[model samples]
Target: MTPTPKRTIVALAIAATLALAGCAPAAGGNAGNDSGGGETPTAGGTLTYGRLASASDLDLHTQITANNAFAIDKIFETLVSFDEHGKIIDWLADSHEISADGLTYTFTLRDGLKYSDGSDVKAADVKFSLERNLAKAGPLTLTAPIANIATDDAARTVVITLDEPYTPFLSELTSFASGVMPTDFGGKTEEDYLKAPIGTGPFAVSAWDPAGDLNYVKNEHYWQDGKPLLDGLDYVFVADDNQLLQRLNAGQIDAIEQVPAANAESVDGGSATTLLNSDSWAIEQIFFNTQKPEFADKNVRRAIAQTLDLPGIAKATTFGTARAASALIPPAIEYSAADAHDEKPVLAHDVAAAKQELAKSGYPDGFTATMLIPSGNSARAQIAQIVQESLAEIGITVEIESIDLASFRERFKAFDYDFMINSGQSDAPDPNGLVTFQADPEGFSNSYWTHYTNPEVTKLMHEGRTTPDGPEREKIYLEIQQILAGDVPYIPVYYSPNLHGTTAKVHGLESLPNGSVRFQDAWLDAK
Candidate 1:
């Protein structure tokens, strides 16, 4: 589960599906359409994936990291699946319905689904998997909404109750954390089950070497008809991004994600391999520790937010792939009715306005503080330098400090900092998770860093979560965005672009809005 924050805790790492102005595709852009007629499907080839980190285990309910999710997603079946745009749809389940009151959900399973071990899946297993997920360390914004779960084996039905109405509740089921396992295999702690996990998925865990390699073979009885074009998958763990890129270039691995921003330019322009680079559903931010006396007043935060040139930073940071992100809920998420998100500038660049606010903040002469960034991310380091210079223009001297990813996370969780250049991926595919998490005093959400206790933010987040109607939910979220634009808790810098490298011979590998790869209908062809 812990693969060193593959959650794309990017300096600007992310993937998502909101239609923003000038937004790139999650798959970068469609390449190899020369075969407009399409090519014949070929099976029996093995796809070796060069992963960003090693998987701790394949147990979904216990650990769901970005690294393992790529593995477990194929090995375990989720109740729902997300589309190219990150909207939730039925997968293992034939259909689902939420109550009008927005507190209960009913799902009917697809007929004849079976575990990789050939065991028939029952509704009881659905109840167990979800309840187990709720019992785990998965994000509370996604889990806390669920109050109860019940099963009816005969009807092949699963019923779920929520403590409150949550708009993204349905989408949350797409996670492998909600992956179903055989009821007979239920007794093992997620640790023991890692030894042998049985699920209704396209692939089965054939071998696991934790630090070396993890292999997955096609489930002979895979429910989908003629699906999973590849015979097997090999996830070779290569923690170093440079090595991963080199391996892909050398044809050592069939594909790789998280291509280093430094190497993206040459790779994207070269003919050696296919480059899929697109906008991701993540936002990198420079957060102000609101509790600190220097930033206790919101005006200082606003001053700093407006001083930075966000567009320039994004272009310079992610090799011109990631764009300037202006909102907490990035432009790639579904914030507008037009399949786009409005990144209303809460504090767009205006040095005069910034100086005015700084003066009002009782820091007209400016102040000195420290900005923490996780070591080893070039994107973050570059952006930090830019921010330091921007703040200096407004009279704030930010001493940039670099710490390891683990310690950075530790310090961030403790809310011990003056400011930080940090990022997070959306666990729940909807905006509710990040919007509310950032405002709510939940330490896990890192909202505590802002020390923001706005009742309006909390109320709108609740309304946006619970409201069942789309139009109504839209109004609530827009107001919430409007408020956040003015509040200046954190200044979003950019939306991390999803950059992927694969052999030009490979086709149909979907770059899901979450920046995940799915090779279900993929095929290999002659070079």
Candidate 2:
């Protein structure tokens, strides 16, 4: 089902700016209550948050989902973090210096640092955490250019030497994937640590159930004094958006993420709740499994791309909470081709052109296919329906299949679908964060599951990573986008804004540009 036409148009108009600015503040209502403005924060309540999905795992080094990152951000501390303005700032490290040649980095740890278990945090922990991530070759492997790590316990310093000058290295350090852990996981088994992980962040996990609620308690040893003003945090998993909103309206939960655009008005109008919307570097797209025989031909893929109207689909699904995406990189990130479509419209919708392209393929009369979408995501469900209708006009029969999140993820990772609607958000401010994950063939296991590769694109990705941030770097990414546009491995749909809902009593909750909600300083006013 689609949102009302009026709501969809209005949302589309407002979201156009979000597509350009990428990190604008909350547009429609109260941005969020901050600790400043002469209003002293009153702490002590345990804020209950309604999450749309359960975290697959809490292992910061291995897990790569946003659900896991949200929980891990609360339990772990990164060497650096992004401030309100999206600038990288020191967190665990008090100061850092980069060599003039850009191959070496030295960081000084904050003095008297202690973990949630009250163990002293040393440079060895940082070295161990990074080395572990490197060995595992997880998300950090693609962006981190580390060659060696040297730590000095006496000086409280860690020095890293890179094989090459990597521009996004510092920004990558801000990701939760780089979050620090004990040298030997606090002397607990991997199984034991996953149950209740300890970190130097604002909170520590007290209990976690894969199918139910996960609970946390304030970290007394957290270095940031008088921060994380809540007594604790309680995350309740609610799979459905409607149910999540109902819990928020019924005062059963304090806040929720991924609020549906159709329900944004209700939340904003309700006296008991508020809607928070902000620009995000998130993109929703339809990925074609090129391994499938039906989609093996580029002409067939481009035919499918031309058959659907991205703007209409985006409007119907997001209800103006997103802008129709023209490029893989959202406009907010550096080196994004914000005007690529204007220069050359590769994926523009044209049913006649689609028919012509199909006529040139093996299946001139079109073919039957199945589209996969994760259940409980209202927007994705709507997108599937819209795509089903659009494809029918060209003699293509599409059967929509909805599966649970876990099953959907497993299928996605296994390349087990003909095509699927999925979304991804940037982990850091640099364009390299999501671009490398989505486009680099060898970097992230065939572009994080698309399995589409181009020799030129691969070379450009490598050049883009080592090249300094300047006109030269921008040219490399622009060329990559142009190439991907013609290859049609994935069809860009829309750039989404981060939408969240909160009870009026909840304050100090802010949405980051990378689509994360900051609950570190959130609190509850007495209801």
Candidate 3:
């Protein structure tokens, strides 16, 4: 089979600036086409998928977790979506247009679109879904700039006006959070709608249990013709990685998500299974609470950053599957300075330089600090251990704390820790998704929890968002990255890769750059 083409984030950024008029459908229709000795596509088998965890909830507007987004992508349809190459393209919207001022966006729904319940999709539903997202104020509320939404039901069109020009607006619309829903939730209460939501996507929820398996059935009224070749999806929850791999190799499960890096080689070598890998938009890093007394000084923060060996940590954790990150933004996102490693060189590991930097700080002799990590994640725990050993050489004593995922989230959001290991991913393909959230002080509290701020960074972030010229915007982001490297608000460890394992029977399973697995077009061969 011919390999699919890949586009850099720069192309995606430039594409966002141009007005999309009467655009064609997104790519990836031939993702796993029968070629290279594969069996012909068949359409009536139910695929059993193994997952490490269960989704917290199916409410697209409220939850943006990986598990939830993966499930929601199939059950809901967004106005726009990213093709395999990362370009924003039309989905539910047959065509769209943007005004010269970049403040107005217009969309026309495709004819004959219907929800799983066979209800017609109209402009009013699109208007209501976007407006409701603004009111919820969730993490996916990238729609906060919308000033008003107007609909013309007769014309099947919706017009949205923003307060100002937001370059990432179109890319943000691809998120599952912006998924279209029935007006007033089909006249059902919010609680009732969430219990059994309906969408115009290729699949509908047949049964769901938070702690057990979740099942889905093909939507008979799906807008896409002769698609969703699989009869249904059976998601089996398997928390243990070893057992998950065993099941896949044993032919008990057709596919598995989140394949551990250490087991990638073994899974690929297995006769019945194959491993899928792609560049991921996520990054693993250690965040410093700038407000805390121990890290309040810039010299102290810089000292700690220089002491840890980023490349060593990455290898120890991901086992060559990931590369040491050179910038806050992952390389997959647009305007990322990740390629500037040689020129910028973000705090390369140096024991002697670290000692000198520490001597210049208020705590000349070093100090003791605690680093927190989620309890169940072995990769993070390994990172903490590596940091503990490295910092010791510089006379800084480090303590590692393991906390439950729930408690860790509460403390993380509350800014209650001195230092912590965490991984973050962009909601969209644009740099505005991660850069603005991390550097823009006016928004999300300086890197979303660090309490670190720079006046210049704040100004540049504003300029980058409103600037329409690609070259000019690139200069602004490059400057911001240089500033961030000097400030050391967070120390980037590695860029994570998206990994999945599938049995020989599975086909058409593609992983998006944002680390999402698309199963809508997947099919299975007869045993």
Candidate 4:
């Protein structure tokens, strides 16, 4: 949840599907040749996964959680993909060219591609997949500037016309929104499709256990040969991360994501498997509700921000893979300037200063604030407890409230708490998402919590959206970061590490931004 001035909040009413277009996958060109051309006995086995929670929907357009993304990445290939080093690489589309003006991008579709339903997937399908989100006008939309999309009648090429220059366009396209889906193939309604979606990737959803499990089977006619090596895939929603770890150690599941940092050492010490770590494209921050008296004052917020031990939190909550963050954009973003001060957050332990600020405010006697957190998120709960103790030292009382994951998210959306811990993931480093916190209706509706507003900040946010690349735009974003730091509307926590644990027998698991997992090339070795 983020804080914003409620009065100035404007909602951009674009289609929900359109919001995900910025992160669509690169077009997967033709890959029709059968692998090894032989009557190989069907390879099938059940691979179980530990999902953090049950997803609200499975429709590619509506699902963005780590568990759903893991399944989707296997079923749908994007036009572009990120390498292990976070660099862009080709995936579905053969090659792409952007006009010198950066407003027009043309994609050459791959030939011989067919949907699981046996319909030819042409450039038009790609265009539809890219634009459908905008047509749906739902909650899952991307916050970039796109003018229009058109595909040639031959269905072999797609062209995108942007309202303005967008340098990070491809990066945003790597999301599920841009994934091509067959039109009205089954009797499934749009809502049903989202909850139990279909796709053209290496596997398809075989069975979904609404309360506890999901399963996927290999596509006999998958586009790529020798793909989806596992016989089948399973995702089990385990509310407890500790239980997930225990299951993994007991050989019930092959992998689990985001092991609690506190228990990571234990997992590492056990013979279960190796703990994988990578730089994540997400930031975990403690957001302040500026709309309320509890955190309305910047002085109080800054004192709180300056008081915590970021390094200590990183070690205690996220293990060694996370680092203290000072800016919205993680260091992995290539465009950040070397001299940017906002990017270099203040990391200090000054409890005395914190106390002085508390004294200056009317709360010299210290007041209690409510903390809303997801009930089963072990990592967040641990971090909140740490924060509770830290703030108590400065005469501030934090009342922790843990609720169900679904209810917790809804509350955050509604700005129903004084403070909370959450994460914002970035596909590529850009300030466009800032609109969600600062812009009107389409932005964080919960901005009402902060009661923070600045026409200048709003103007700069629009500028960043409209001007994808330019010296002026870069300067504005840097300034925006600085302003945010000074405002102290959000307390900088640590950027969590994207960690994945895999048994040695499982091969070809790749890490993506947002703590997502991709397994196009994965295969199971016989135990």
What TM-score, over all chains together, does every model reach? 0.84, 0.91, 0.92, 0.85
List the lowest-lDDT window of 10 residues for candidate 4: 5-14
- Report the C-alpha lDDT of model 3 over 1-527, residue by residue, as the tens digit: 00001101111232454664545675545442222255677888899999866765888877766768888878888888886557678999988888877788899888889999999998999988887776676656644367889999889899988887767677777888889999998999999998878998888889999777889998889888877788899889886667888899899999888777778888778777888877877888899888898788999989988888888888888889998988877887777898897456868788899999999999889889999887766788888998999999988899999987767877977988989998777766777667666765545444667877898987786677667757888888888887887788888789998878888778888678777777767888766
Per-candidate alpha-carbon RMSD to the true structure: 6.4, 7.5, 4.8, 6.2
- In model 3, which runs have C-alpha deviations exceeding 4 angstroms? 1-17, 20-22, 28-36, 442-446
Best candidate per lDDT, number?
A: 3
lDDT values for all models: 0.69, 0.77, 0.78, 0.63
Ranking by lDDT: 3, 2, 1, 4
Instruction: Show the lowest summed lDDT stretch of 10 residues, model 1.
Output: 4-13
> Which is the leading candidate under TM-score?
3
Ranking by TM-score: 3, 2, 4, 1
Clash count per candidate: 11, 2, 0, 47
Native-referenced Cα lDDT, model 4: 0.63
Model 1, residue 430: C-alpha shift (Å): 2.7
**Worst lDDT 10-window in candidate 2:** 1-10
Residue-by-residue lDDT tens digits, candidate 2, 1-527: 00111100000111222222212211211245544345666879899989988765888877777778788888888777775445566788877777777777788888888999899998999998887776666654434556889999889999988786666677767788788898888899877887888888889888888777889898888887766788899989998988998899999998998689888778888888888877787889899888887788888998989998988887787777788888888877766675767466866799999999988888888899999999998888888998999889888899999999989989988989999999867777776666667766655435657778788987886677667776777788888888888888898899888888988888888678777777767877754
Better of 2 and 3 by TM-score: 3
Model 2's TM-score against the true structure: 0.91
Better of 3 and 4 by TM-score: 3
Per-residue lDDT of model 4, residues 382-466, tens digit only: 8899999999898788999999887887787677889888776654334444334433333434332445666676776665554
Q: Candidate 1 lDDT, tens digit per residue, 427-469?
A: 5457765665577664345463567767887777656655554
What ranges in model 2 sit over 4 Å off?
A: 1-31, 35-38, 342-344
